[model samples]
Target: MKIVKVEEFDLRREVEYGSAEQNEAVRTIVSDVKKEGDAALLRYTEKFDGVCLEPAGLRVTQEELQAAYSQVEPSFVEAISAAAANIRAFHLRQKRNSWMDLQPDGSLLGQIIRPLKRVGVYVPGGKAAYPSSVLMNVIPAQVAGVPEIVMVTPPATGGKAGIDPYILVAAAEAGVHEIYRVGGAQAVAALAYGTDTIEPVDKICGPGNIYVALAKREVYGVVDIDSIAGPSEIAVLADDSADPAYVAADLLSQAEHDEMASAILVTPSEAFAKACQAEVERQLAELPRRDIARASIRDYGAVILVDSVEAGIGVINKLAPEHFELIVEEPMAYLGLIENAGAIFLGPYSSEPVGDYFAGPNHIIPTNGTARFSSPVDVDDFIKKSSLIYYSKEALLQNGATIVELARREGLEGHARAIEIRLLKEGKAGTNNDNQ
Candidate 1:
């Protein structure tokens, strides 16, 4: 690892940026699915997932789920159950209540909160089985009182038409209504534009490869989607007191995610920065995914030696990292100064994986500097709000002339006429100049 002084501007772009080829491929997949429906989905699944699945048999059945449960160890199932309980408990606090307010002039204003009719959660399957993602995605929708929560993942090889046992168990614990074995851009298309077997969803949420992100972008108008996620990233803000080993391990945790993932360290101590760098090299050599982590660190990772803690904080806010860990003397001291970040981990014990798996926070976070304007998935993602308004006759009479006058000024005669006709029918306004 190399340590460099912080600069005001770094012109080089990160390699993790999405490509035009991916966007075009996603567009093609979405179009094909829209035209051929289930047939297109089956064909793409075979091509990408290396599994042949008929549309009718795509959905996972209760019997299959039971078999999956039987395949997994009881201890792993217990852990999944525990994690689900914690995730559910945390998101339940985010639940919103509908409210109405009455005005003195016989007017009522309020907002009604309702869960979306249905939602689709995409979980990646294959070499990586994310049972934790299943919990994070489904638990929030369940907490928001969503009636139907459907999940989709790519089918495994050898005629396996369902998710791994851990994923299935987690989905069950999170109250998912349905699960399907479909993957990639085609899965996104199926969720966005319902096929014969898969029901259309009002919204889709999850993380996936570049194709998945692009597919979500193309289908955005047809169905609401979570953010277009990029590769995972983490930024550690530390001082002299921070432990180098802990810092290095935390950085590698995200770096190992992919060759494009970024791991940055912003520290005030030059000695600590060097120690972290050395420790990162030592630890990377021992990781099973060392090749991926080494490439990620060499390409996108950074260790900036800032002049002061304030400067470190400024750099963090500028980066708007997906996962931010504060390993300073007082991690909470600079909490108020952080204006942007998908999630913040305080103190040495709060590792990034804590929130990724067992912690209540949603791990489906915004990446690639999107945290400046976006937020992690939460209960609100599964719910919609409608503003309610009611005006009594007295209230209408009180404001009708002013409304008409405003409409007339805007040259919208129909708008003025609509109010004028109503007021005239009630005998409240005989002439526009009566009050004047």
Candidate 2:
């Protein structure tokens, strides 16, 4: 990690929008899936995942779900159940009911909040298992009252010919019964355009590789997506009072995610900055994913020297990081000062993983400065709100003239005439109608 002045440090890292070839490949895959349906889906599965399956084998059976429990340990099930409860409880708080308002003019106006009919959660597999992601993605949609929640993961797990047992267990624990043995851009395509095996989903949510990201972009209008997420990031805003060892560990937690992942530290104390930098170096040497973390730290990690904690907040606001940690003496005192960040961890005890795994907050967050305008995945992402407007006869008569005037000002005579026709039929228009 390099140490530099806050002015010299730049946090506007470029997002990977995928290569032209990757985009063209995703387009071809999406088009094939849309045209050939299950045939193309199975072909892509075998091509990319090195697994062959018939249309009947695409959907994971209940026997597999039950067998998955036997593969995982009792402790693992207990832990996942506990985490699911926390995730479910947290998202349930975000649930909203449909509501309406009655006005004095006898008009009914409000919003009709309803869950999406179905949602698809794409969990990345092959060589690694993200059971946490399964819980994080599925639990929110369940809390939103989505009738059907489906999951898609690569057919191969750890380069084997089956899905990861831990992932299957997580899905079952999260209340998702429909699981598919498919993944990547093809899976996204299948979810957008229904096949004989998989039904179309109203929305898709989860994190994936560049191909997955591009696939989500391709099917955005056909089916809504959570976001075009970028590489993971973590920015620590700490002062001299914070511990360097704890800070270094927290930074590496995100840095280990991938080479593109960023881990930054902003501090007012030069001594503390140097200490954290050395601690990060010491810890990086021992990390299991040291190669990935080292590359991430070398390319994207930095220790910025700000004039004060107040100055650090300004830099953080500009970065709009996906994950933020405040380790100063009084973390809450500066909480309101933070203007951007997808998830915030305050104090030493509130590590980034707490929110990532067990702290009842969704780990799927906006990345690559998107926290400036976007948010982490929540119940709202799984639901849609339709505006309700029941205009009474008297209400329309009272506002019809104003509506006509506004419409005519825009040179939309058709709109003006529509309102005029209603007003004239109600006996409210007198001598003002060009229709006469």
Clashing pairs in 1: none
TM-score of 2: 0.97
Evaluated at residue 60, the lDDT of candidate 1 is 87
What is the per-residue lDDT of model 1 for residues 1-436, given as tens digits with 9 covering 90 to 100? 6788888436234544367777778889999998889999999888876778777788888887777778889999888888888888899999999999999988999999999989999998887889999888888888888898899988886555557777887777677748888989999999999998888999999988888888898899899998888888999999988889999999999999999888999998999999999999999999999999999999889899898989889998889999999988887888999988999999999999999989888999988788889999999999999999998888889899988888877877778889989999999872364233
Error of 2 at 262 (Å): 0.3
Please provide TM-scores, in order, for all candidate models, with all chains considered together. 0.95, 0.97
Which window of 10 residues has the lowest lDDT sum in candidate 2?
Answer: 427-436
Superposed Cα deviation of residue 277, candidate 2 (Å): 1.0
lDDT of 2 at 291: 97
lDDT of 2 by residue, 178-245 (tens): 89999999999999999988999999999999999999999999999999999999999999889899
Cα error of candidate 2 at position 231, Å = 0.6
Q: After superposing candidate 2, which stretches have Cα over 4 Å from the reference?
A: 157-160, 430-436
**Evaluated with TM-score, which candidate comes out highest?**
2
Clashing pairs in 2: none
